[model samples]
Target: MKEFDLIKQYFAQRGHVRKDVILGIGDDCAITKVPDNQHLAVTTDTLISGVHFLADAPARSVAYKAVAVNLSDLAACGAEPAWISLSLSLPSYDEAWIDEFVNGLYELTEYYSVQLIGGDTVTGPLALTITAQGFVPPDTELRRSNAKPGDWIYVTGNLGDAGAGLDILKGNIEASAEHRDYLINRHYYPTPRVLAGTSLRRTANTGIDVSDGLVADLSHILRASGCGATVHVDRLPVSSALFDTVGAQQAYRYALSAGDDYELVFTVNEEQRGNLETSLANANVKATCIGQVNGYTGQLDLRLYDAKYELDKDAGYEHQF
Candidate 1:
């Protein structure tokens, strides 16, 4: 099938879209109208074939993650899904691969109420890129720079499952069937906490998604907010399944430094603690108070059960060599 033909067959179907879209695929460009008094937030992410995933990885999962990662960025800023454009770099045309990939992307766009707009495709080494645009109320968008020294730090959901899952996939460890399933799911289908982020926009003083390790990602928030933190290791959330399978200490390590957990890490002023807790409960999300923001400059200190550890100032995942 021709490239445009494939796109029309797989993505141009009306059933695959939700509202707020003025135009979809098949156009030279997607025309959109942002609602009144709303600010648009845009983010783009690229997943290279071998660098981001194995070439043999399922095509559908690759597409889903390609969009999901970009959407995760929009959610961190409390933006509502609006539109997406895709760029594809392929080694060859494989109808089966395209079908599965479009199916997964369509499913997510439908769920998030986003529209598939316009994009570009070219022949090259296998790679995928997604640029997603969302809308948020003016000045109500959450940011990483608003946290104050007296604020409390909190994170949504457990962390490190994805990293553990990757370890298992790479044959570095053996896990039970249940543990394996849990880890694999974590790796494949990470929830981006979109609803939680939106709800907390007005309340959270600082916001970030855990794409990098928690300690590292949270440090971005700290740097932007110009405040330091003391994260209580005991307060970091970890799944019971993790402890049963990976052991407590290992689980703690994973929860702290393992990346790809897409949960939200945020801060709220001490005076708003009660309101923040109530808001999170109403949203049906778990929000754990992990620590407190301090006036210390440029440092992250984590206090475990007995010992304290300070993270290397420059530790984080970087794709470039």
Candidate 2:
């Protein structure tokens, strides 16, 4: 089928449209008017077949994940997703596959109240790129460089679920049916902590999403803020599903080094911790204080009982290309 035919038959007008969007798909450009009091925040991500995802992955999951991950970037910066543009490069257009994909994409965009905007679809090796735009109040956006010494480092939700989930997919371990389903879902669908990030905007000294492993992604905030951290390995939260599927050691490794959690890792001051918790609680977000920022001149430490260690290396997924 032709490209426009494919969109009309399956992909066009598939999601909710927010009021602020002046134009959506079928336009040369999607026009939007940002509220005068708000700042626009935008982020983009691309997923390629056989690289970011398996070749035969579900069409729905692929579509959902493409927008979801980009929204996670928005969440890290405490932005409210308002619109998104999709660009798909494919060998050929297939209406059935496109329908399922658009359905999945619509599900997430609608749930988040984000509108579908403009993008270009081309013929090529399979690649899906999405650019999501969001809004945050002026001067209230969270930044990786804002953390300071003595700030309490925190993370929303449990870590290592996606990492452990990937291992199960590779057949690295045998698991029960329930365990397999749980882990697999963890890999396919990661929840972006939008509410938590929005709430932390006024309180968090710095913030980042745990797209890479916890240790690795948190280091971004540390490096940007010109500081170090001391995380308690024992305090790292591992989900019950993870512990039940894989033992503690494997789960811990996933928590420390496995990627794709899409959770928020942030820093707040000691004195404001109670108020921070209250804010998160109001947003129905759970967060844990895993560490504290140390002085800029000293090395970061992860205190394990009486011992400490340094996490100063490329500790995340290595992508080639």
Candidate 3:
């Protein structure tokens, strides 16, 4: 099938309709209207086969991740996702694969009440790019640079599951079928913390989505905020599946260094922490306080009882262009 035909058949108008969309697919550009007194938050992510996922990864998973990761970015900024534009490149026109991909992609966008705008499809190495747009109230959006010293650090959900999932897929680890499936599913279908992020705007001083390793992504916050932090090794929320499958030491490493878990890492000062916790609790999110911001500049210390260790800067997967 031709590229345009493939896109029209599988993707056109699949995203849920919203009043703000002036024009969606089959146009030179998708036009949208931003509500009054609100700011638009936009983010884009590119996923490549063999790099982002296994070459044989399910098309549904690939499509889902493409959307989830970008939505996670919107969540970090305390925005509600409203629109997405997908640019997909496929090596060949496989009907079943295309159907599955659209099903997964549209399922997520529809769930979030986001509309599909416009994009292009082409023949090439398997890759997908999504540009997501969200909205936040004017003059108050969470940012990585807004964290302050003495603010407590918190993360939603357990960490390292996705990294462990990848390890399982790569044949680098062993586990029973049930445990393996759990880990693999976590890696493939991550929940973006949109509601939690929105709640954070009222309490969190700064935040980021855990796309890279916890330490690496936290470093971005530290650098931007011109501060350091003290993370407790014992406080890392290792999932039971990961802990049982790989034990404490390996689980700790994965939680600290593994990526692809789309949880939120945020900061709240002592004064606002109560409200923050209450808000997240109301939203039914599981969160834990891991540590606090420190005065040191651009350094992160992981504390385990009486001992402290500097995280290896290169520990996580660094996407090299």
Candidate 4:
């Protein structure tokens, strides 16, 4: 199939259709409308075969993850997702693979009411890049630079499951049948906390989605906010699947440094603590207080029930180049 034919057959008219998209697909450019009094939030992510996922991973999973990671970035900014443009590079035109991938991509876009406006397709190494755009009310967007000293640090949902799941896929760890499926599913489908993030805009001083592990991502907040934090290692949330499969010590390590859990980590001050709880409860999202921001600028202190804890390896994933 020709590139334009492939786009028309699989993508041009697929997924949720948003009214704000004035012109989508078949055009040189997509024109979208931003609602008055709101700001647009944009994020782009690229996933390469063998680097982001196993080359033989399911096409559905690859497509789902590609969209989810970008949505997670918008969620961190407390934006409501509205549109996406997908650029897909494939080694060959495998119609069956494209079908599965489009199904997975539309599943998420439909759920979030995101429109696939336009993009490009080409023959090359397997890779996918998605540029996702969303909206947030002016002055209400969540940011890493807004955290203040004495604010309580909190994270939505459990951590470390995705990291452990990757290990299982790479044959570096073993789990029982039940635990294995659960962990692998977590790795394949990460939930971006859209509602929770929007709710936090009214309460959280700052926030970030946990993509590159808790320690690494939180350090971004510290550096941006010019504040230090004291995180209680015992407070880091670990799922039953991760803890049961890897034991306490290894689970804690994964929670701290293994990365790829797309849950939100946010900070809320004492004055808004009550409101934070109420807001998240209303959003039907679970969150835990892991620590507090401190006066020491650009420092992160990890404590295990009052004793100092240190990471024995690199904090999180970083591109070598």
**Best of the candidates, lDDT:** 4
Q: lDDT (0-100) at residue 134 of candidate 2?
A: 92
lDDT of 3 at 244: 96
What are the clashing pairs of model 3?
none
- Models, CA RMSD each: 2.0, 1.9, 1.5, 1.4
lDDT of 4 by residue, 1-321 (tens): 499999999887667888898999989999999999999999999999988877888999999999999999999999999999999999999989999999989889999999999999999999999999999998988999999999999999999999889889889999999999999989888888888888988788998999998999999999999999999999899999999999988999999987779999999999999999998998899999999999899899999989999888664765211
Report clashes for each candidate as comma-separated counts. 0, 0, 0, 0
lDDT of 1 at 256: 83
Candidate 3, 1-321: lDDT as tens digits? 588887787777466889999988988898889999889999999999988888888888988888999999999999999999989988988899988888889879889998888899989999989999999998669999998999999999999999999889889899788999999999888889888889898789998999988998999999999999999988899889999999988888889999999999999999998888899999999999999999899988898874985566677766521
The estimated TM-scores of all candidates read 0.94, 0.95, 0.97, 0.97
Candidate 2 least-lDDT 10 residues: 312-321
Ranking by TM-score: 4, 3, 2, 1
How would you encode candidate 1's per-residue C-alpha lDDT over 1-321 as one tens digit per residue?
Answer: 367866677667754554566776788877778888899999999989767766667888888888888888888898887888999888888888888888878778888877888787777898988999998998878898898998999999888787788778878777899999898778777777888888787888878899878988898988987888899988789987777778877787778877778899989997778888888899999989899899996677899864796545554544321
**Cα error of candidate 4 at position 265, Å:** 0.6
lDDT of 2 at 25: 75
Q: Give the local distance difference test score of model 3.
A: 0.89
lDDT for each residue of candidate 2 in 1-321, tens digit (9 for 90 to 100): 477766555556567867788877776777789998999999999999878876777888888888888999999998988889888888887868877888888889889998878777789988899999999998989999988899998999999988777777777776788878888788788887878878988888888888778877888888888898888877888888888878776776788888888889999998888889999998889898888998763356777664775443565675422
Number of the top candidate by TM-score? 4
Ranking by lDDT: 4, 3, 2, 1
**TM-score, predicted candidate 1 vs. hidden true structure:** 0.94
Give the winner by TM-score: 3 or 4.
4
